[model samples]
Target: MTTDRVNGIARAWWKEAVAYQIYPRSFMDGNGDGIGDLAGITARLDHLSDLGVDVIWLSPHYDSPDRDNGYDIRDYRAVSEKFGSMEEFDALLAGLHARGMKLLVDLVVNHTSDQHAWFAESRASRDAQKRDWYIWADPAPGGGPPNDWPSFFSTPAWSWDEATGQYYLHLFAPEQPDLNWENPAVRGAVWDLMRFWLDKGVDGFRMDVIPFISKTPGFPPIPEGGTPQKHYAEGPHLHDYLREMRTEVLSQYDVMTVGEGNGLDQAQMRRMVDARRGELDMIFQFDVVEFDRGEGGWPRDWTLPEFKAIFARQAASMDAHGWTTVYLANHDTTRPVSRYGDDAPGWRVPSAKALMTLLLTQVGTPFLYQGDEIGMTNFPFTAIAQFDDIAVRNAWARAQKAGTADEAQFLARLNRTSRDHTRTPMQWDGGPGAGFTSGQPWLVINPNAEAVNVAADRADPKGIYDWTRAMIALRHAEPALVYGGYRDLAPNHPALFAYAREIGEGGLCVVLNMAREPQRFALPRAAEPVMASGADLEGREIRLDGWGACICRWS
Candidate 1:
C-alpha cells in the first residue's frame, strides 16, 4: 500500500482515478463471432488510452448460461469461451497495464449459475457432501415455495427441486442460485476464485450485487408491503464475510475494490466502504439513480429539487469519513443523453456536454460508461420480443398478469426502463451495424447511431468526445476537482444548478441551466471562465444558454 497516512487514515489510488466501464459483450467483436471477445477488447486499447481513463472496469465474462448475461457465473476463475480463452484475457490485461491503466474484473461472489459444479453436487441429495453450498429449504405449510419472497423474476424466490424434495433460493432468475456464504467452505472457495484472478495480474474487482452475499437466518417471508430485495440486502453476516474476504484475499494485493451497493442507504454505504473497516475501498450507491424509478420500478419524471436532494445526500460522501462514485450512465442504465439530458436533435450536443460537466466536477471518482464519450442515446426498441434482458421480460410479464397496465402501456414503459437500452452495439461510424461487428450483432444497433457516433465526433472540436477529453484533462490538472471542499451555489432554483469546490486559494464554481430556455445565475464573485458547455459569460453573472453549463475558477 503506497498510502500516505494522516493520523492513520491514508489516501488510496482509486480515489484519484476515473473508471471507464465496459460491457464486454457489446464493446467490440474481433473474432467475427458477432459477440464481443477479449481480442476485440484488446484491439480497442487505443480508444481507452485516448479517453484518458485511469481504470477499465469490465463486466463479467465468466462462463454462464446467458440467463442474466454473464452475472450467473459458472466458473469464477475462467473466462467464457464466447469471450475467448484465458490467454486472451491475459493479453488484454497486459495491454491495459502497458497503457498505464489498471484492470478491475467483476467479482460475482454473491451467486453462481445453477449449472455450476458446486450447485449440481449440492442439489444431488440432502446428505450430499456439498449440500449446504447453496441455500435450500423445504416447502411451506401449503407444499408450495418456502416463503412469500419474490424473485427478480415474477416467480417465488424459491424454485422447487424434485430430486432433493426441497427448494433452492434464487433471488434473481432461477438459473442464478444464491450462494450460502454462512458456510466457511463457501467463503474459502470465493477467496480461491479471487486469488485465481489476482494471481493472473488483474488489478482489482467490481463486486457484483456484493451486499447480497449474506442473508438473514431462517428463510423469511416478505411482509405485506415489503420488497423481497430487502430480505437479502445488507444481511446479518455481510460485513463479517466482507472483512474476512479483505483479510484473506484483498489485503494481499495493492488493488481497489468497489461494491455494487444497490438498495443500500447512506449509513449502509458508509459501513460497507469505510476505509478503516477493511471491507472495500469504495461503493456504488443508487440514491440519485432511483429518483426516476416510480411505482413497480418504472421510469418517472423527476423535479430539480429531487435531483439536488439526491446529490446532497450522495455528496455527504465527500466528508472525511467516506467517498462516492459519480456517474450518469452504465451498462444497466439508459444512456445519459436520453435518460437525463435532452437528446432532441437541436439540444443533444450541449445537453450531453452539460451532464459531463456536472458529473466530472462532483466530489467522487467519475465513472464513464462505454459510448458515453460520444453521447450515445438509447436504442428505440420497437417490440418487447426484441429485448433479451431477463429482468425486463419478467417485469413486463408480471405487470401484464397483474393488469397494472395494458400491453401498450407496459411496452412503452419497457422501452424506457429496459437494460437493453444500454446494451446496444457501439456506434463506431455511420455504417452497417454501426461498424460494431462485421456480421450480425447480438443486439440491435441504435437507429440514431448514423448521426451520433464516435467517428463523427472524434475530430470535431465542439463534439461530446472533445468536450469530455478537455474536461478530463482539466480534472487532471486541478487539485480542487480531486480533493476539494464542496458547497452548492443554487440550492432551490428550478432550472439552474450550481455548486462550488474550494481548495486552498482557489475554487471551482459550476453553473447550469437545466431548462430549455436561457437562464442566468448570480456568481458569488467575479471569476475567470475555465470551461463552459453552452457559451456566454461576462462578470458576476453569466447568462446560460438552453441546457447550458459553465465552470469558473476564482482565487
Candidate 2:
C-alpha cells in the first residue's frame, strides 16, 4: 500500500479510494432463497471490481433476526443462516481481498439484538452474570421509562422486561438493546469481537452509531420540546471509548475506520476524525445527506445554494485536518437520482453522471450506494404494507396510532424519503427479478429496472454506470482530486456548481450544471477538457447542456 504525506499528515489508500456499499440482503441472491447472501456477493464481485471501487462496505450479515433488516445482530462472530454459513462468508472476504478490494463490515457495537447471548443473559435476570452488559434501569417515579429518551424508530427508548422486572435502554428498535459501555467487561468483549474479524483478515469497519455507545453521565431527562438525539449523541465518554478502541484493536492493523457522525457538527466531526485525535480515519456527516429530511419522516424542499453551502462547509471542515465521506445516498437514504438529481426521463442519465462527477471530484473519499451508479430512482410505493424498513413502519404506525396519519400524504412521504427507495434489488438485467434472483426478491424491485438495469447501462458507453466507472478511474489517475484544496467558483449560482481542486501546480476544474436548463460557466483559468457528459467547451468557456458536467485538467 502506498501512503502520501501531504503537509505532515499521512494519507492512505482509503483517502484516495472510492467505496461502494453492498446492502447484502438486497444486492444479489444465490441458491434461490429469495434473500441475498455471502455467496451472492462473491458471485457478483466482478461488478464492483469493474466499477473500480477500492473498498466494499458490507452491511451487517451477522446472525440476525432480520427485524431491522440485519441491523439487529444476534451474534458477533457468526453469519446469519439465512444469508449463508461461516465458510461462505470467508469466501466472500477472500473474494474481496483477491480482487484488490478491502472489506469494511458494519460494526454495530452500540447495540445488539435482544436475542444475542449477552443480551439474553442480561435480560434473563438481574443477577445473571451478564446482567451489566446491557443498560438496565428500574421504572421511574412515574412508572414509565427510566428517562425521556426516545428510540430512533419513533418510540420510547425503553422496553420493559417481564422476567427481569426492569426497563432496558434501546436507542433503536426494542429488539436492539444498547450495550453498557461503562462496563470494562463489555468493552473487553467488543475489542475481542473486533479482533475476531481482524484475525480473519477483514479490512476495517463502518461503525454504526458508534458515538451513541456512550451516554450522558446521569441519563438526564430531556427538556420540553428537545430532541432525544441531542441528549444522547456524542456522550461524555465517546472520545475515551474511541481512543480505547483504537489502542486495543484498530491501531494494530493498517485498516480504515469510518464512523457514522449523524448528529455531530463540523467541529465535533473534526474532533472525531482528525488524525491527531486517533479516534477515526473518517466520519460520515449528515449535513449533506439529510437536507431533505423533515419532521415525522416527511420530505422538505431545499434550494441549490443551501445544498451547495452544506457541502462546501463539510469540505471546509476537513480542509485543515481530518477526513469526511462524500456521498449522496446510502441504505438509510432515498436514491440519489430521485433525491438530488433530475430523475425524469431525459435528464436521468446526465444528472446521475453529473452527481457522480461532483462526488469523485470532491476532496474526501467518495462512497457509492449499490444502485446509484445506474441512475436508480425512487420506487413508487403505493401502500404502506409494501414497506419493509422498520423506521418507516414504526413512523407510520405511530402516526396512525396518534390518529394524525393522512394515508395519502404519508404514502407520499414514504415514496419520497423512505429508505426502501434505496433498498430495492440491484438491477443487473432486464429479465425476471432483474437478474438478482431466480425466485421472488425479498423486497420489491424498482419498477424501472427494465429501463435502468446494468446490462443496458453498460452497453451504452455514455450511460451512468460507465460514466461512474470512468469517473472512478479519473479520480484514481489524478492525485490532485484526492489531496487538493477545494475552491467553489460559483457558490451563489442557482443552476451551476463549479469548483476547482488544486494541489501544487497541477489541478482539475470540475463544472456541474445542476439544473435542466442549459448553463454557461467561465473558467477561472485556462485548461483543456479531459472528460465531459452532456457538456461542451469552447475557448475556456463551457456550455453545460441541461444537467451536464465537465472535468478540465491543468498542469
Task: Identify the candidate with maximal lDDT.
Answer: 2
lDDT per residue, candidate 2, 5-26, as tens digits? 7644466888878999999988
lDDT against the true structure, each candidate: 0.84, 0.88
**lDDT tens readout by residue for model 1, 1-555:** 555743223566787788899999999999877898899999989988998888999999888888889989897878899999988998999999999999999988778999899998999899999999999988888788877787777777889899989999888889999999999999999999889989998889988888888888886666777766565689898899999999999999898888887767778888987767888878887876668998878788888877877777787754565677888788787888888788888888888888888888887788999998998887777777788888777777787788774767777887777788889888888988787888889988888988888889896888999888888888887777877877888778888889987775577898888879999887878889988877567878888999898989884
Candidate number with greatest TM-score: 2
**Cα lDDT, model 2, residue 414:** 77
Candidate 1 has what TM-score?
0.97
Among all windows of ten consecutive residues in candidate 2, which has the lowest summed lDDT? 1-10
Residue clash pairs of candidate 1: none
TM-score of each: 0.97, 0.98
